[model samples]
Each structure stands twice: as C-alpha cells, then as structure tokens.
Target: MVLKCSPIQLAHSVLLTLGIIWLTPVWAAQEIRVGAAHFPPYTVRPERGADTGLLSKLLNALNQLQSDYRFVLVPSSIPRRVRDFERGRVDMMMFENPAWGWQELSYTAVDMGLEDAEVFVARQNPDRAQRYFDDLSGKRLALFSGYHYAFAGFNSAPKFLTNTFSATLTYSHESNLLMVLRGRADIALMTRSNLIDIQRYDPKVKSQIMVSERVDQVYRHYALLRLDAPIKSQEFAQMLNNLRDSGQLRAIFGPYQIDVVAM
Candidate 1:
C-alpha cells in the first residue's frame, strides 16, 4: 500500500526526524561537572557571570568534539574545592597537582602532560637584579591565599605562611603584583602563565617588573577524578590526547606559555 503525501506533510516529517536525531544525544549524554576555581590563566573570572579561561575553553572544545558527555563548570574556591570534590558537588577537578593536598584522597590522578612554573616577581629597580630573588630571608612575601608553596614545604596555612615566611595572603594576583611595585612587598609569587597574561594585557607593566630566572616550583598539571566520577581518568586523558593531536590545546594555551607535552 503506497500512500503519496503532500509536499508540506513530507517536509514536516523530515523536520520531525531531524529534531529527534539532534535531541537524542542531549538526552542520553551524561553530565560531567568539572570544578573551576579562581585559578588564573587556567580559570579566570570564575565568580563572574561567565568564565573566561583555559579550562572553559578546553571544556567547550570537549563538548564540540563529543556527544557522549556534557561537561559543565561548577564554581569552587581554592580552599573549598577539596571539600566540594569529596561531597560529590563536582566530579572532576582539572589543572590540579597531586601534591597540593590531594595525596590522602582516594581518587585517580590523570597526568595532563602540561606544565607551567611558579616564578618570583619584583619591582624593577637599578639595584634589583636576578640576585635579588636568590634569597628569601628578610623578604616580605605576597602570595595568594589557600595556595600551597614549595618554599613553605607545601604549607598553605595562612598563619604558618605569615609566621614562617612573613607572607601577606590575598586572593588577587594583581593586588600581589601591585604590592611589589608599591614596595609594600619584596616579592610576589605567581604562575608563569599568569604573568604572561598580565604582561600581554599591560605591556607597560612588563617593563616595570623583573621576573626571576629561578622558578620556585614547576607545576605539573593533572586532572583529579573522583572514584565515582561519570568518566574514568583514562577516558579523560584520551580526550585530552585527542585535543593535543588536533592542535586545539596548543591554540588555546600556547600564547600563554603553557606547555602541552605529548601524551
């Protein structure tokens, strides 16, 4: 039995079919909540309405590349991320280091094969040279609160940092840098990628500061996944590898001086 349909009916049927096909993935895709902290260059403006950072970009790329999962950002602070992860508020945390207080947690650590270092910054002066960064004694340090420092034996306690290193803890990297320029602080510790972004935005500020040749620590990035995460660490690593092979990672992080090592 062959029934001929009108042009309008045929068009309607085609449209309905297309809509169902498009909606299938969205319905079936698992939600993967990624923790986004106020980590600059990696995650900037996280508290703002819309996040603009490498993590956001990477998630966008991941979404576009696959339909099996839907990646979303769950805002968390540096100090609260660990709690959030344990509470299942977020399934994954990217740009993390295992040594940064994640050692005791039972989770899978996926090597991101990316690297960025922490460097010292100080105001430029005739008397100040690379040698100025060689010593930490008698120096007032400005650092981000809730960040573990290798110099302090990975201690992130505000009281410990203040008493042991004479540190001024703050949330703003810009403020830390300004403290150095204003001579309120002798040195400010910040990520190399962050410094690059700052210098790129404010070229004039670049000349006013001296970056240290000695790095305080090299940040070997990782993705820490909960044991019950929607996806396994191996799967996440493969997605990152795909991004690396397609040059997406390089395009996103290369300008910021974040190294994307081959997996």
Candidate 2:
C-alpha cells in the first residue's frame, strides 16, 4: 500500500471521474414557478379541477419546448402576488404591466408585445343611450376588489371608490357582471377578451350584457421575473418568441379576440 502511484495513473483516474460526472447530469431541471391570479381570459382557476386560461395555454407550449426548466403555477391573489414575489414564493409573473403598482419591486421586465383592453359592460337596455367611461361620478360601479383601473385613478381602496363613485367592489368578474345584470350595480369593467370567451360559452351572458364602446386602457403586457428567478430575462423572451414563431401564440388568443402585438 506504500507504493507510489504513477502520474499517468492518477491523471487517468481524475479524467474518468470527470467523465462520469459529465455523463451523469447531476442537477435537476430548474423550476420556474409562475405566479398566477384568477384573471379570466388570461388565467382562470376553476372550482372542480385544474386552472385553465390563455396564460395556462402559453405555459404549456413553453414547457413542451424545453427540458432545462419546468414551469409550474403558484397560486396567488391579485393583492397577495407582490408579497409572494418578495418572499420568494413565486419566481415570475406573466402578462404584467409596470403601471399596475409594481414599480418598486425588484424584477426583470420583458415586454411581451401583447395587448388587451378593459371596457365597460352593462345590461342591454336598447332604450338607454350610450354611456361613456369618462365619468364614474354617479354610477354604482361593480368593481373588482383587488384591481387597479385607469378610470378609478388607479385606486383599489373600496372606501375611496365608494365615496368617490358608489362602487361595489368584489373579487369575481362573474359576480361583478351579475350585479350589473340584476340591477345591483350600474356597470362592470372587464377585459374585452374575457367578454368574448364568456359570450361564446354562456348564452346568458351574451343575451343580457352589452359591451361598451368605452375602454379604460389597452394594456401593453410584459413578463416580470423576480431577481432570484432561475432563468435570464432575455432567455425567457426567447422562449416566448419561439412560441410566437410556431403559431401557438396567435392560436391561443385569436379565438378570444386577443391579438399579439409582437412576434
């Protein structure tokens, strides 16, 4: 056992070990946890089963395109997402905008080149004249509790909105729209794409509500990656672009009336 090992033997052993490590692929696939809220036509969490929506479709295509990373959804509410991101509960957020109160957060911003508009929805009463979105002064608005709207001066506080314009803020878009139909609220602001999807699936929604010619804002969407996220910002964009090139992007949104702003 006291015999000296030759330099060549030692070198071969080291090389063999290195080769084994190289072949073994020791690291697990990097997990990219995406923060998802119940934003219909984008991400919808169903009552009985798995979540389904546009964002869900996009993530599926992205997952199919690679093996280095596995994307998974991390459930979050509209108000709770920022805290989750800061606490590292989620690694990224899709279909986001900086103006949506995310300015102070530490994250990489990647322009998605996607656009969706939020418009006013009210019950169909052909006898009534067209109502504009410029004023919320006397309206009993059915607003989403955790959302920021351009017309509301980007305010999400129920009390402030209530004092300003008789608003009934709730979490569900369906509920908001229902309030409008049942004479509980004067109007509900919702995404144009969601309206299309809802109208297609539910004839009740189609027969009762009328989409306003008034729109609050056309969102130029983006992907926000936390500072500690596994993938680089540019790399995530590349994955998205790959989906764009493959016709998957348009396919997912085209039927819903959501057009891709970029390829």
Candidate 3:
C-alpha cells in the first residue's frame, strides 16, 4: 500500500522538525565558571546585581565568538578566590598573577600579555615632592583589603598591614584615594589603570593628587586554569590570541591603560 500526505501536512511536519533543530544545539555547551572578584576596571561587583568590567566584556566577547563553551561569572572575593578555585567553585581565574599566593596551587598559567602597575597617590602640596614618598615610616597608609603589595613583602594579612604600616584597610580604591585628598590618610596605593579611570571621570583628581613615579608592583597578568578544567590552557590561550587578532581585547582593555601584548 502507498500513502501520500497533503501539502499542508508536509509543511507542518517540516516546520516542527525545524523548530526542534533550532531549540537544540549540536552539542551541549560546556560550562566554564570564571571567578569574578571586585577588581576595579577589571571587574566590579556592586552592592547588588551582576558584575561588570573588562573581564565581563572579554567574557561576553568570547561567548559570542564560540558556542562550544559558555563562560559564566562566579562571584568570588580577593581572599576567597584561590580557595574557591581549589574547591571547584570556579574553574578559571583571569587577570591574576602566579606570585600572588598561587605558588602552592597546581594550575596552568596562561600569560595574558597584559601589564599594569600599582603606584602611590598623595594629596598635592607645595612642600611635598617625590621625596615625600621615599619614606613611608610615619605615613598613614590606606590600602585595599586582601591585596598583596611588594612593599609589605607580599603579605596581605590585615593585622600585619595595620600594625606594621599603620594602614587602614578598605574595599574601595576610590575611598582610599579620597582618604588622601581629604587628609584622612597620607598615602593610598592605587592601580595605574584605576587611577587613569578616576582621572578621566574626575579631572580634578589629576591636579589634587600627586602620583609617585615609584611603583609598588608591576602586574604581569595571567589566566589560571584548574588542572581538570573543561578547557585546557593551550585552548584558552588560543582563544585569547583570537581575541587579540580580532581587536576585541584592545577594544576592551585599551581605554583602561592596560597593555595588550601579542601572545
């Protein structure tokens, strides 16, 4: 026996099949959880809502570039991020350095080919010159909590910073800068990228604050991947290279004064 379907019925069948194909991907996109810490100009976690920064922009661009992997931001703190990565809470960490307490962990480090530096910010005064920054012995330091500074021997202990350096630990870089501007603190250590951002938005900051030529640390950024991560370091590095070639990375990080070196 032979059967023939009507044109309307055949069209309906085709439409249904097309809908199924549209709804399903060729393969499930592997989920890659990236740690999102509150690093200004790199990543910012507001009092509420999702995080945003250069990291966010880079992730968004990576997502649009490929469908095999879905990169999602997982909230983590400066002190807790290493632990989170160790515990499998996050599979990847971007804009990190190996010397920043990661020596003990076994992970592949992919050099991000980016560079930034930490500099001192102080209120401008007629008498204060570059010499004022030469000695921090009696200076009141305003520092970000959980951040390691070369000046402090890379120790991020709050009590150590407070007692040894007479430092006040806070979470906001802006607050630290303001501390200097208001004479609440003698000096504030800020990232060059962040200071540039602040000066861009508030031009008065450039005139009111004197930035030291001395650097606390020069950040050579890297992306650390867990040993068992879905994506390998080579693969991730290639992805970054793709972004660099396509100019996406420059578009995202250039404005912040971050160097986009070829991989």
Highest-lDDT candidate:
1
TM-score per candidate, in order?
0.90, 0.87, 0.90
Model 2: lDDT to the true structure: 0.84
lDDT of each model, Cα atoms only? Answer: 0.92, 0.84, 0.91
Candidate 2, residue 15: how far the Cα is off, in Å? 17
TM-score for candidate 2? 0.87
TM-score (C-alpha, index-matched) for candidate 3: 0.90
Error of 1 at 207 (Å): 0.9
State the lDDT of candidate 2 residue by residue for 52-75, as single tens digits: 877778888888999899898878
- Ranking of models by TM-score: 3, 1, 2
Of the candidates numbered 1 and 3, which has the greater lDDT value? 1
lDDT for model 1 comes to: 0.92
Off by over 4 Å in 1: 1-27
Candidate 3 lDDT over residue span 142-234, tens digit each = 999999899999999999999999999999999999899999999999999999988998997888989999988888999999999999998
Q: Write the per-residue lDDT of candidate 1 for residues 1-263, one digit (tens) a residue.
A: 99999999999999999998887854678999999999998898687849999999999999998998999999999999999999999999999999998877889999988999999999999987799988898999999999988888998999999998899999989999999999999999999999999988999998899999999998889999999999988888899999999999999999999998865
Clashes of each: 0, 0, 0
